[model samples]
Structures are given as C-alpha cells and as structure tokens.
Target chain A: MAEKKVYEKTLGVMPDVISGFCPGCMHGTVHKLVGEVVQELGMLDKLVRVEGVGCCGLGQQFVSHDVIIAAHGRACAVATGVKRCSPESLVYTYQGDGDLASIGLDETVSAANRGENFTVIFINNGIYGMTGGQMAPTTLIGMKATTAPFGRKVEEHGYPMHVCELLSQLKTPQFLVRTAVDTPQNVIKTRKYIKQAFQNQIDGKGFSLVEVVTSCPTNWGYTAKEALTFLREKMFEEFPLGVYRDKDKEEA
Target chain B: MAERVFMKGCEAIAEAGVRAGCRFFAGYPITPQNEIPEYFARRMPEVGGVFVQGESEVASVNMLYGAAATGTPAMSSSSSCGISLYSEGVSYCASARLPVVYVNVQRGGPGIGAIQPAQQDYLQATKASGNGGFRMIVLAPATVQECVDMVYEAFELAQRDNNPVLVLTDGVIGTMMEPVVLPPMKTDEDIKAMKAKFADKACTGHEPCKQHFCFPGSVGTGQEIANKEAEKMYATWDKDVRVEKYLTDDAEIIFAAYGISARISRAVVKQLRAEGIKAGMIRPITVSPFPYEAFSSLDFNQVKGILDVEMSIPAQMRWDIDHAVQGRCPINECRRSGGQLLTNDQVLEGARQLIKEVL
Candidate 1:
C-alpha cells in the first residue's frame, strides 16, 4: 500500500511550484488565498484576472486562470474593459499599493465610483518592493524606505493613505474592507473578505475591493517572524483592520 | 444600395465603426472628437454593444487594450493632447499584436496649443506614436464621405494585419457635415462569427490557454523575435499604400497634400490646369505607408518641382516628401499653423512660385 497523501494541490493553482517573490513576501500567501477562494466558489473555469506590475503581477504564474497583464497602474481600467466585454465571465484585478493607490488612483476611484461589477485585490505593503524598497503611497509615518532614508517625515513625505476609508466615501461600492495576512486568524479573516468580494461580484451587486495589509520583509529589513510582529504592533496602529463599508449589509 | 444620410463626420465615423462590427468603444471627451463618444453612448446600447466614457485618455486606451485582447472589435477617439496620453497604450497594443482602432481628430499642439484644426501631429502619428518605435496604419480622410469609408476599411485592415489602425482626420473634417452612403450594418450572427474566428487566441477565460496576453518584458529573446515578426508584417503593408492622383500622367508641377490640405490642392490643381500650367496633385489617403512610390514613379524629366501643402508650420509631412522625392526635384512648403487654414489661392500662388523657380 502506498503512503497516505498528506497534502493535495489547491484547485486553480499550479502544483508544487515556487513563486518568484522574496522569502518573506506575502504575495504568495495572498495568491494562495485567492486561488483557494476561487476554487471553493467554483469559478475556476470562468475566472479572468488582470495582473498588475511588480510582485503582485507574479500571481499569474502561480494561478491557473487566464491572466491579462495590465500596464503599471492601469489594472482597474483593464478589468473594466474585460468585464464589460464578457459580462458573464468573473473578472478581478490583483494590484499593489503603488500600482493601485499611487499611479492608478484615478482608475481605482473612477471604477469604484462607477460601480463597475468586478473585484480588486489590492496588496498594501507600504513600500515599493520590486523597485527596491522605495516609498509607496501607503507607507506609514516615520517608516524608513530607500527613498526616505531618514524615515518618512510629516513635513516632507505626508502620511499613509487609508484606501478603504478613502473609497468608502463613495456610495456606489458594494463592499470595502481592510485585512492582513500576518497571522493565521487574520489570514482566515482575509480569506473571508476575499470570498465575500468575489461573491458580491457573482451576485451582481457592484464593485468590491479587499485591501490586504501585507509585510515586505526584504524591504523592511526584517525576518519573516519579525515582519509579522511589526505588522501586528506597528502597522496595525496606523491601519486598523476592519470593514469600512458594506452596502449589502446596509441594504439588508 | 444603402441610403445616403447627411451626417457630421464624427457621427458618420462612429456609425461606420458600429457597422464594421465594433461592439466596444471607450473614449474620453476632447475637442472635435467628443461627438464620437457621444454618438457611441447613444447608439451602442441599441446595437447590443458596450460604451464607456473613461476617466482619462490613458484609461480609455487601456480599456480598448482589454476589450481588444478578448478578440472583440474595439475603438477610441481623441484629439492631440489626448492622443499623447494614449501613446503608451497604443504601443502596448502594437507590441501585443492586438488589433484596435483609434481616431485622432487633430488639434494644434505642442501642449494644448489650440482647439482648432492643425496637422502638426503627422510626425507624432506616423513616425513615433509610442516608445519602442512601432508603426500603425494611419488613414487621413479629406471629406466626410472618405471618413466613413476609411473608418469602415480601417476595421478590416486592423483585424487582417492584427495591428492598431489610426484614423488621422483633423478638426475641420471632424466637424464638417456631408452626405455619406453608409455601409450595411453587420448582423449579430456576423459579429459572432468574426469573434469565433479569433477564439483560439482570445482571452475569454473559457479554457486554459498558454499565450500570455501581457507586456513582452519577461519573454527575453521572445521580445526581439516578436519585433522581427512585426517588422516583417510592416514590410508587407507596401501593397496597401493608397493615394488619390489627379492628372499626374504628364505634369511639370505636382502638389503633395493630405486631409484638409488635399481639398485645397485639388482646387489649385484644377485652377492651374485651366491656366495651362501642367500642374497636378497627389493626395495621400493612407498616410503611414506614406505613398513613396507615388513620388518615385513621377516623370522627373518633365517635373519642375513639388509643393508640400499642409496646415502645420515648419511642415511635418514635408519630411516624408523629402525622403520620397530624393532630390529628384526641389521640394517647397506651402503651410499655415496655429488654427490657420490653407486657402486654394495660397496653394496656387505657392505652386506658381515653385514652377517659376524650377522651370
């Protein structure tokens, strides 16, 4: 008799393959969660992802869905086109903080305001990881990035942006939430939010976004364990994790 | 025969796009071309199509990228500054080999110079549309009827070559109205069949396909190979070069023009002929595959000189004329800029001056 298999491949994900992200990078974990939710929801066949630039763009190689890579900062606009052309297909965009909140802010806000029927998974890591740890739009105050060698100052570098709160002011978005992947419980919660966002799209509710506050260990100069600790203690102090808006619950 | 209707140039082009089976249109409002998106917004729903007024020209072109990647016929329209914003997405479409159509009802510009008609973007459109030094099929229509015809033909050529096509009209023709015989509307079945032919390459998310519909940066040597293939495709476009020749069989003076400038040149050519000047006009209908053969095949022994007419100062299209003529005859520029229109009298006077100097 063969030895009992301890693990099986997640549906809609490549089997036993390593992603190109750094060792402590949370992009792989987020990609796994997205794959698991897409598989659990039975949308593997109908899922189309518009991949953004940077480490977030590497999700295409780890997932088994048809992915169209968008130019840096244009993922939401690209997703809008894909969704409008094929309304029956499930569409989503995976973007980084730099791609989503900085360069692509107009596309993000406009798509949310217009209530485009799709999902956006925005990974907010507070620093530009692929471009060598530069300051990102979501970088916290006093954070030390390559661009901010002396730590971010309020006079020069401005404060971190709460994207969920910024977008919740619009009345059209169906769901807006901020979660993290630093802990097992928070990862589970992040999965729930991701699932809800996709379900909202499937239910034809409206635009939904799940902003995942992740850690960049290489950029942060911390080990994997220290990155989780910093996320829990320091990052959470600035970006408290919770649902900012839920139109479905409000309507109910 | 389809019934003729008096329509604005922009509206007629929009209708022709719909009839050509373009079901997706994404555009941002700009001078002289806003009527295009406005018309699509009103007509797309009736034809079971999708229309989006994007946040900006940047978003509009990327939206076309997404729709076109699905192998659906998609289009966008803008003026000068907006086209500048769209340059990146246009280059992406060319590199990815996605056949999309964009119309530039040009305005004067280095940066929002004026809202009125100008042909200053000729170099930008034909020479360097975007980075990576790619080429697009650029069509310049002198009349509203030609606008409708070229727009209809542009969709077919875009799909046939799997490349981006630009309908490079100007503010004058974009706002002008005339009677045009519209093409027959493509049936729903026809559109479906056309899309089905691209099913193998389309990213409809129905099955797992190996082709990555993304930027070509990570493909290593594959990027160079794709560039070579694109270069070959561009070489084959020589047969598709089109121009309207008016009595160049035996002439001593020739006028080279396109778009609104061509209209003035046509009148100038007729006036010169009536005065027994042996003058003619060569109007380029397709500007990108710049009709070099038209100049190369001219009888140099009888030709006096060529007057390059345009609505741009410093003469943009004159460069192509210079390259084509290759010192066979002296090339002179008859041009106006900054929202100024070239008159027939001005062109005739310029032609006579060149004729007197050369002969």
Candidate 2:
C-alpha cells in the first residue's frame, strides 16, 4: 500500500479566524464554550444556535451548530421556535447583556417562565460592546461607559440589574446560575456551569441559563490582563457568583 | 356545499386555519382579535395541536416561525398594534423563505390608534410590513365568509410559494359574528404532502425520493439561487392575485376598496346602481399583488372616475388605485381615521359628489 500523509491543519473545529466580533471581546470566549458544548454533547448534527445583534450576533462564524441570526434581542424567541419545531434538536442562544438583559427582558423571563426546553448562554460585560460601549443595564455601579461617562450613579441610573437573581425568583426556570471568567478559577467554573446548563436542556429539564460575567478590555480602557482583574475585583462584587436556582434539585 | 353557522370572523379564521391543517397556533390576545387565540386555546388541543399564548406578539410570531420551520402548518393572529410588533419575525420569515400564515385583523393606527375597523394598515400590509425586499401576499377578506376562506387560501399560498401570507381584515370583520360554511378539514396525507414540499430548503439536507436522474442541491448553485427563487415567486404570485368586479361591466364610476371598507362600498354600489348613477366595485382579494391588471385593463376612456374608500385619513388605498390607472382615470378618496369607520352614507355622498364633479 502507498503511504499517504494525513493533513493536520484541516480537522474538526471553527475556521482559522472570522469577522463576527471585534478583538479583545468576550464573545469569542462565549462562542468557544457554546461550540465546545455542542461538540461534547454530540449535538452538532442536531443543534441550531440562534444569534442576535451585538458583538455576539453573527454566531455563524464560530458556532458550527446550523446557526441562524435573528433580529436584535430576539435570540430567545427564535430559539423558542427552533426548539418547538424540532423538539429532537438541542436549541441554544448566545446573547450579550444588552441583547438579553436590556432590550429582550420580556422574552428571557417569559421563556424561563414557560420552562421552554432550551439553553441560554448570557454574557454580561456591563456595556454595549458593538455600538461603541454604551451604558448597559448590567453596567456595574459607578461604571462609566459612553452613555454614562459621568459615572453611573444610583440616583440617576438606578442600581445595576442582577438578571440571574431576578430570573431565579421566577417560578418556571429549571436552572439559573451566574459565573465569571475574570480569573482562571472562575473561567473553569463558568465552563462547568455552561456545560451543565446545556445538559439540562438536552435532558429536557427546562429553561436553563448560564450568565457569564465577562469583560471588554478595549471598551473598558484596560489591558486584556487588567480587564480580567477589574471583572474579578469590581464586577464580581456586584453580580456575585454561584447557582441561583436549579429545579432539578427541587425535583430530586 | 353551502351550509350556515353563526360564528365570529375571528373564530371563523381560527376554525378555518384548523381545517387547513394548521397544528400550531401561537398568539397574544389583542382587542378585536382575541377570539382567534381564545378559539385556538379551546379547540387546538382537540385537533392534537399545540396552542401557546405567547407572552407578547413578538414571541408569538417567533413561535410561529419555529413551528412553521418544522414543516407543519403554524399560524398566528393579531391586530394592527400587535402586528407591528411582529415585523421582526415577519422579516425573519421572509428572509428565510419560510411559509407562515399571519392573520392581521387591523384597527386604526399610526400609533395605537384604537380598537376599531380601519384601512389604515393597507400600506403596512402590502408595501413593507417587514425588512428586506419582501412582499407579503396580502389577502383582504371583506365578509365573514371571506375571513374563513382567506385563512385556508393564505396557508395554501404560503406553502406554495414558501413565503408568509397575511389575511388583512379589520376590527369589524374580526369581531362580527355571521353565517359561514367551512370546507371539510384537510386530511393528514394532504398536510404531509405540503410539509414535505415546503419545509426549509436547508434544514433536513437533500431529498431521497427522486424518480428522475438525481442532481445535487435541490435549488442548484448559490449564485443563481436568489434569481431562481425570485422568478419562481413572481411566477407563482401572478396566478395568486384575485379580485372581484361587481357591476363594473357598464359603470361610469368604479370604487376600489377592500376589507371592511369594501363592505361599506358594497352598500354605496347598490344605492348608486339603483339611482342609475352607474357606481361599481372592484374588490381586491389579494392586496400585496394588488390586482393591477384588473384596474389597468379597464377602458379608462369610458370610465369617468374612481373613488378609493377606506377608513384612514389621507387615503392609503389611493396609491394602489392610482398606480393601476397610471394617470388615465380621475381618482378621489373618502376616508376617516382614529378608530372611526367610514359609514355607507358618507361613501354614497362622496360617490354622488364625484359623479357631479367628474360627469
């Protein structure tokens, strides 16, 4: 038999690079987690990940899970359709804080309340990373983005919204957790929680949410390393970390 | 076979959709159209379908999108305010070329106008209800029977063209209870055939049941894909636009109207014909294609004038009328907005005045 050299570069994974998100954005981290989960669960063939507008909008770039980009803040609703239409496939959404927590709060809360069998991966960077770092609902106290350059004060801006805590209180959500990737320890924890959230949906448990506390180094005016420190020191204090609700436990 | 039963227009639409093989109904309750979801809530389960009262119109339309993408007949109904909320999903459906039947029972609106019948949504339904170069096959159902008939035809057209179809009715038509005879419900085999043909082109990959020499890709090359789709869509739409002409054969003046406005025009037509004033009606059944040939083919030299009757200020239907006539016929408009219906007497008065001014 003739010897043939197997190509090493061409293998199972995302493209070498893509134009979906800007550099130093946490969308890449979230996308990686989502793609990894789809692969691990052997659901890449039976998955449809709906994307929304913002930094993480064009999920088609990295999400090899038969991705479709919906209108702004409509990922959850679109995923609802995908999951309902094909209950066999595992449906998920990769959304940003502005996409889910701000403009799409109704869909998020309602889908959770309906206990829709799907997974939601929410990234809270506390700013609109796509539209030039505008102030977002998840923006931490005293944080200054483009819209809140004077510093987000409680009197004028209201308190930073903790979506995980708020959604955990709702009666329908089966799994809700808040984790961060500010450090190596939290990064590992975020991955574990994200995998579990996807697993719950695959098991037809119900609506599962994994809110990852992430960072935008360019938007936050910090080095990539320094951005991680800020997320751990400041963002962690306000948002906290750990599971807020798990219906699977209640059932047990 | 003509049978009779007293049912609300909205209820007729729901029942007709059920008969048309729709197994998924998702919608939010809005005034003048709440009966649709309520009916579905009661009857959808009996047919072994899923009925979801979506949290909002946005979610409802999205749910429709999801269900329809699965190759099943899925439908959603809402009024003008709620339909506006569904624009995002409409655009998504349009871009994806998914077949979904959307029922828009319109009320007055530039912004939350009122819960009353109006033709204010003519432009939104026909022109650009959503984004992209998209045109929905708008079906204007003037009578309660039409509300029943159009719902079935809308899904049929939706599946045929693999595009969304809107049943554009008004608050009166949606809320009014009248006699209607619905056709026999579609069989599972019929629905299965449609589901196989109209499901998303990319979803389940390619076909396994080709009789002839099989070729890769059902739609062919990516470069020629959109043009081919456009050509197929226009060809299909050519046969889909339907209109009805009453007393137009020997009329000096013709009234172009649709939906509840068309119902008012009918009474005016009857009174004008009795008075020998020769007023007729050309009711557009499909508002998106707009039945341009029906108006353009008429002998404009013999026809003196056209009055576009609607219930919205500034006459939205006048645009389509003028486009059809192409400056050959004189056009006038009679309309009222802000949740008010244009009464029969008002239309008669306008038709009489137009006769005096033009003839």
**How much lDDT does each candidate structure score?**
0.89, 0.80
How would you encode candidate 1's per-residue C-alpha lDDT over B23-130 as one tens digit per residue? 999999899788999999999999999999999999999999999878789999999999999998998889888889999999887798899999989999999999
Candidate 1 residues A80-182, lDDT tens each? 9989998888899999999999999999999999999999999998999989999998898889999999999889978888899999999899999999988
For candidate 2, lDDT tens digit of each residue in A41-143?
Answer: 6666666666667877655544444555666777787677667767787777878889998888888888888889999989899998879889999998788
The stretch of ten residues in a row with the least summed lDDT in candidate 2 chain B is: B207-216
Q: Which pairs clash in model 1?
A: none
Model 1, which residues run further than 4 Å from truth? A1-6, B208-217
Candidate 2 per-residue lDDT over residues B152-249, each given as its tens digit: 88888888777888999988988888999997888888888877785445342121121011011123375257546755676667777799998999
> Could you tell me the lDDT of residue A60 within candidate 2?
56
TM of each candidate vs. truth? 0.98, 0.90
Scored against the true structure, residue A85 in model 2 reaches a CA lDDT of 63
Q: Which candidate is the best by lDDT?
A: 1
**Count of residue pairs whose backbone atoms collide, per candidate:** 0, 1
Q: What's the lDDT for residue A51 in model 2? A: 67
List chain B TM-scores, each candidate: 0.97, 0.91
Distance from true location, Cα of B96 in model 2, Å: 2.1
